[model samples]
Target: MRSGTAPPVPSAPARRLLLTAAEWAVLVAEWPGALPPGLSVEVPGSRQRNDAVAALVARGVLRAPVGGPVEPVPAVAADLAVLRRPLLTVRLETGGRGGRRHGWFALGADVVVVVLTLPDGGIELSLAPAAGLGAELARVVPEAAAVTGPTARGGAPPTGALPLGLLDAAPAGRGGPPPTAAEAALAGELLRRTAGSLDCLVLGRAGGPVGAGQVSWLATDGGWVGLRPHPGGSPRRVVDVVSVRPADLGTWVAPTVAALLEGRA
Candidate 1:
């Protein structure tokens, strides 16, 4: 198996159910024998199915028909139980003029799942989960969260939280001044100049500027750019920008946006 961190702890009930289910599925898939008399098999409360079989073996509900080596089912179940309450958190950051696109950051008990989404574009989710479920999910959604950026290539950016200002400055729409020719031209210029550097570009109705300051761009060679107008100013003046690269961009952008909408960011 590929090596990586452990997975987040599922709830106890969830974990138990998941383990039970895995036991049943495995029994049905492999053993195909009658369940011992008066012995009850159940799925864990969590949705994990693979763990169910492991739980059964751990519980001693199923024994090897050959009477050779007993599977270490109980030990595995205990391990799963221990992981049920693992602590984890996810963060997201959105950039560009439109705010429709974003990046994600996930910090779980043992792994992380970062994602990025571009306006009217495809989604990119990255898995950094601990062992167990997180790793299992990584296998399930390999296409959804492929790591292709600098970090995957061993050139990660400095490890630091994205500036709150950058998160706040995510665009309200496509990163254009307005429907007017000048605004469209400026927005196009920004995209043209920063092609491949920017994960997304947007232009639409701008939200009022943030706070007392007007929107501005942070200079970076290859990163993200956001645009928003100054707070309390006319929406027309609302333009914000930030810098992000195509790879690491997803790691902190999408999950943050999801968290914000969920009132967790």
Candidate 2:
């Protein structure tokens, strides 16, 4: 299966950590059988670097399902547990997977369903109300219009956390400014450029093999989604890692996003 986006470099603060010698031995590429009695390794630098290392030991390169019905499969039990109540779940076909309903899973909840064709990857989440929500439907916020609003074209700009509704908007009606997690952090100018409903979630360093790979934007490059295998012993063992860069970025991304002028989504 395809792989997800990788994490970023950890902070550079010199430090020391103690690990068992056997663990250290795992670092040895030459497959040294074992460590001698009474031994340990003192590792210096950030432990964040070893996140991939630990994941490899826990679950090696995950392989894609070789042959399974392309038809829909149930979401994982763990995944289901996390998705409860008012918090509805919707899947989008970031890649060319699934049918028209492919991205929209049938969860049946009081939620606005959105099918976002993100950069390279797709995410199915909520954009419902967190208490008092906008009664309005989705609309494409034109570049000029976003600024013309009463907030004034040259205002302080949006800061702090955006409303839950604004971030997870449904891709219909007049879609709002579809901001990527990246855009939300950046000044509104970056967001003003795009006018589409596709967004990216900046999930720090992708926890490799921890769950499925995570999806992230790569600035100039498109987006990528991580996919890991469901557990099964080999013959069944798939490739350890797979990375699928979306065929094209910005194929999505257009006039849906509006430049925020402080205190707005």
Best TM-score goes to which candidate?
1
Candidate 1's TM-score: 0.26
Q: For candidate 2, lDDT tens digit of each residue in 174-234?
A: 3455545743454233234222222222111122211111222211111122222324533
Tens-place lDDT digits, model 1, residues 96-208:
33232343333444444333343444333334434333332223221111221222122222222222222333554644343555444545444444322222211111133
The top-ranked prediction according to lDDT is 1
**Candidate 1: lDDT of 74?**
57
How does residue 103 of candidate 2 score in lDDT?
29
What's the residue-level lDDT of 159 in candidate 1?
A: 23
Worst 10 residues of 2 by lDDT: 254-263
